[model samples]
Target: MLAKFLPGARGAVLPLAILLLVVIMVVPIPAALLDIFFVTNIAISLAVLMVALNARKPLDFSAFPTVLLFTTLFRLGLNVASTRIVLVHGHEGEAAAGHVIEAFGNFLIGGDYVVGIFVFAILMIINLIVVTKGAGRVSEVSARFTLDALPGKQMAIDADLNAGLLTPDEAKARRVEVTTEADFYGSMDGSSKFVKGDAVAAMLILAANVIGGLILGPVSHGLTIAEAARAYILLAIGDALVAQLPALMLSIAAAAIVTRVSSDKDLAGQIGSQFGSPRTWTPVAGILTLLGVMPGMPHLLLLSGAAVAGFAAWKLHQIERRPPPPAPVAAVEPADQSRIGYEDVSDGMLVRLDIGYGLVPLVDERKGAPLMGRITGVRRQLSKELGFVVPQVRVVDDINLAPYTYRLVVGGVVVGEDQVSPDEMLALDTGQAVGSLRGKTAKDPTFGLDATWIAPGDADAATGAGFLVVDPGTVVATHLNHALGQNAADLLGPDEVQALLDGLKERNPQVVASLTPQPLALTTLTQILRGLLAEGISLREFRRIASAISIAAQKSPHAEDIVELIRPDLGSLIVQKLCGVREPLRVMTLEGQLEGLLGQAARADTSGRHVIEPDLGRRIVDAITRAAQPLIAEAKPFALVVQPAIRIAIRKLVKTCLPDTPVLSFFEVPEDKAVEVVAVIGASQPAQAGHFQPQALPA
Candidate 1:
């Protein structure tokens, strides 16, 4: 039984037994001698514990030197004053001398009190910083342990779901639910630890003050200890509480502010309900202070403070154990026509778009407007090039979908779609009866017919297409800036204006069908430009020739050709302008030119040709071409490549002409049958043209 209670019992029992004996001796020491004994015991015990903890799990102690220094100063001051006062003045002396000596003694004891108070204050500060900054780190650790336990908990909810966990929506929901709950509990635990630690430290200091004063003050005949312990305790408690009150109040105030800002009713209600309870602690503290003011109630204050600390600790623990609330349900549209109204018929609102053969209400009475009329005008313009009626429409307020993609629906069911921006939507070939629409209508009560339209294919055919309706107001605002070079309000009349609504609706089909690839091409070009700039190309050089480069590269040249054309210009410019050098630099002039020359030669003739041959020339060119293809594909209209010397000059000229395309370089090598053409990309030295030295490639 002993062995079970204490692992490695034989090894540990001797030290623990010795510790108990020392603690017993130290605890019984008289108040006058207690300071040295207690301090020594504490210092020794702490050192031992620290060493053991370090052996098991080392700690980073760099953060605590300030605390250590403060404690050391207080200890030194106390010891010096105590030694001076006790040695110089005995129990008997002139009345004035006695009083002066005692005053000096009080200063010494005051130093000890200050040390305790400072230590507690430092601890509380550290705890607060950790809780705020390291909460995420704590949560990550907690999640690792808790996530493994999730499956067991989920199994208890449903047995069948356990076997097919992947397919079970409940299982996936439970995973997220468990993770969220774990995070909340972890955060609460950190807060609780900080609060409990502070409260306990405060209680300890109060106890020390009251008990120490009662026992020690009288022994020195109202001379030595005085009321130093009690006074110090009260001061520490008052200062600590006052100092921390702002932070505590701020935390609670922040929670309240968050509740007010949120549109979520449940969150607001929960915050409002919790606010009343924790808020009461403030007033309770005031009442305690009033009680402390009464004569002969110092002991009572101490006891009450201890009790409050204990209760706070318990409450914090309870909060850590409390279960999280249920997850929110997904929003669903109403099925009944009665639920539809002008108030509900706003632009930018999310709505389910259906394209089934079944009859759909042409006129929704709630909005006092006809849906068919609004869509007809948009569809007519789209049909001007390709004739057809659009089958369905769905409206939404926001467009924060995933990159390079848009959602597509057909007959109330999602079909095929591409991930691209609205501009890129125009380049894609959307099949028959498929297109996108955008615009506001008379039926839209909010923000009216000021919305952008995105469709697939020509607007002429609507019969087979599907619609994803978005807020007409937002769409008009988006498209009006593009089409009319002004805001939606400036381009269209009020929401109720039928002609304006009709015009927007007519434009919707054309807008929907305009989901072409042109926008994606532009976006791709932009990304390439950004990447080159990030690689340290100058903004002035980038802007000067980016457009021409893009136009030149659109023809899709072979990778080798692209590199040959761009590299020399870009590399030379980067070396000269950025690296601060100027000259027509040949391969022989470079410091690390040999490795590059060898690498190119080896790559051209992988069969380990000892000498450069005619075939190597072709191989080198082919390799270079292959490397340039991807760079060209990624370059934007404004992308520029800068290099050193010759390459830099070449790049500058290329940039002027092909501002929108990638620029490359060219260098000649001897032709040989054994060697295949090879390309070197990035910032590397040019291969030696006359190299024929036999050398093995590095492993």
Candidate 2:
């Protein structure tokens, strides 16, 4: 059982050491071991200071706060142990406590206990008032500022992730680093109090040793006043000095860590790189030289300093004046400026978005490239709805475009062009806005609705007024999405059709094997799929489509005939897209006489297409368009149910005006679904407006 936990056993050392320190407070220790403990405390303090100085940033030494606590606790414990030894055995000699304390007492203080006392007082003031106090304040302010900046930094990370400049893992790592920095500063703020408290404890420990040792030396051990002063008082100051020096070092280390600015280089390197300029050193050399020549100054030392400063200034100046190294040249000759490669002339991207210079910030990586992320989302959504991987939209800056304008191109043709201010939002009045607003009046780029370009700050007010507000990136993205929908048929080709078949073959091999590269060629299949997409049908269910095409191909040899034969198989899919299974299908129809006239012409011609007189054709188109307007106003999906022979002719006739409205044959709708006739074309009756009128017909 222990073997499972052994890997993490290394973390137990710190707790064991802390427990030992706690024991030392109550237990008495001999002089020999006490010397080792005192030395180890000083060494730990020095090592911590060195590590603090070498850290490139505060977070680089994230463990310093915990280390500060441990070192402070251990130093206090040493003071406790050494104080016991000093009072109990001071009558013997200065070395009674330990050699480490004796050297500080006798050799450093030179038997003058008063001088040692003054030195310890100075160290205490510097640690408590100067270093520890300053570090605490810096940590407090740094923590506050770091937390305050958190929201903006997090948004920047998200923007970069969406813009494709950073991968998800890299963004996650940066977020962790930001959070750790905030935590480190907060810990440092708390840890600085440990240093302050340690300084206070040192003063108390000194007093305890001196007062306790004095009363005990003469009364308990029968020593004279002179001998007692020589032994106990000096030893007290010495022991306090041993602990006080390490405390001062820790205070300095805490200050250094909290004050440090994050950088790629260490403290010494940052200082040298920033301060080595001749601009700073030249003034230093000149000022020092003038001071050296002053009558009251120490001429020799000041002149020597001036000379060294002058030499450093000259070296810095020479380095600054040196030119950078020349870039390496390729061995091959350079191409002529006028010459161009195929990459310059050919564009591999099927979809491209070009923005003007004024709109560059929307796609600028430093600005988080908000448009790039939005474009990526548009491509992802279109790819999902179209059942094929949409080509990447290449965003480029074009100088030829006017300011704030962007153009979307599909297959080298400009499908859409519009303008949107990068720093403004569009507040669209979607038939619900009640109040008037003051701003630049414009039409919604995606749909021509009344819109105003308003500042982002006004978004709440606009929403309160029932306006739908969206950002500039959203406006551009939605425009691009709309354009892609209209041109979806152009997005598919032979390669895409083949990929579809191959994917279907993986799961439904028989269906694919019977359909493709057999009765129908790849080009014919591609054209058929394009026709379906042109009429607002998605190929998401590729297996079903492949099976339908396989069955339809058996009765029909031509691609158009196959499409007609396959309509019954795909009826459910088409109806489901237009409305839910439970919702009745809303429809418009040609009057009996009008349908027969077109049907007769369709049957008379060998070709599927039927020609009608231009005036009559115009009247028939106007009647259907007028009838469909009410359905459009209500936002209901409806189709024109017609004779199969004339459905193709009717479809081509109305396609230019009502591209999204479906033209279905009599047998296309599922038998289980209910149908509500919204209008009957060419019928002499009262016109019904904005409501469904139910009617019964022969089966």
TM-score versus the correct structure, for each prediction: 0.22, 0.56
Cand. 1 Cα-lDDT = 0.36
Q: Which candidate number has the best lDDT? A: 2
lDDT of 1 by residue, 443-491 (tens): 2212232222344442333323543244332232223212211111121
Model 1 lDDT at residue 132: 29
Error of 1 at 471 (Å): 13
lDDT of all the models against the reference?
0.36, 0.84
RMSD of 2: 14.2
Q: How close is candidate 1 to the true structure, as a TM-score?
A: 0.22
